[model samples]
Target: MDPTDAFFTQTVVGAPFTVLLGRRRQPGGSQAEGLHINLATGESRLSQLWQEWALLSHATPPGTARTRPGRVRRLMERHALWVAVLGLLSLTGSAVSWGLLLWK
Candidate 1:
């Protein structure tokens, strides 16, 4: 699979299981060792994650400003075009210089 597709899948998967956890709330199962081991640690991590998700989810569209990438890409494309042009010009200049030296 493409790296980008994998990245998107991972992004969604890593999103707090809590986002949909409420909808699928199952009755607590038998308290296994894993379940009881770090209740406080898990709760605090979830709490902090939820706060971050809330901030991101609630942020205004204007505040996000995602268009910077397109601008950066255009700049890079322009730079690439200039580099290509410069390479061709230098090659042509070298050819002319070689011809002049041969004529001498």
Candidate 2:
């Protein structure tokens, strides 16, 4: 959802942390609180959400989302492969060293 669409620059009243609230019309023709996005307290989580939102919303003329993914996304996607490669390399190196020692 667009941040501006769901929320305005105004903050909610009497919140422990900075929160932006959006109002929606109820069936009774009264305004009701619709969204409550806790901005300051959940900054780290929201930062990722915002970055992902930017990657999705910002578009080139050709209509591609983005050339590069966010840091959190990149690490999450590659963490397993990198760890597996390191483990395999260490195991092979240890085997090779053991072979040489056994030969001597």
**Pairs that collide, model 1:** none
Query: Best by TM-score, which number?
Result: 1
Show how many residue pairs clash in every candidate, following the order shown: 0, 0
Q: Which ranges in model 2 have alpha carbons more than 4 Å from their true place?
A: 1-78
Instruction: Give residue 47's error in model 1 in angstroms.
Output: 48
User: What's every prediction's RMSD, in angstroms?
Assistant: 17.4, 14.2
Q: For candidate 1, write residues 58-88 as lDDT tens digits.
A: 5556456654458877787879978789999
Ten-residue stretch with the least lDDT total in model 1: 29-38
lDDT by residue for model 2 over 55-92, one digit each (tens)?
76544644456579899888867897887898999999
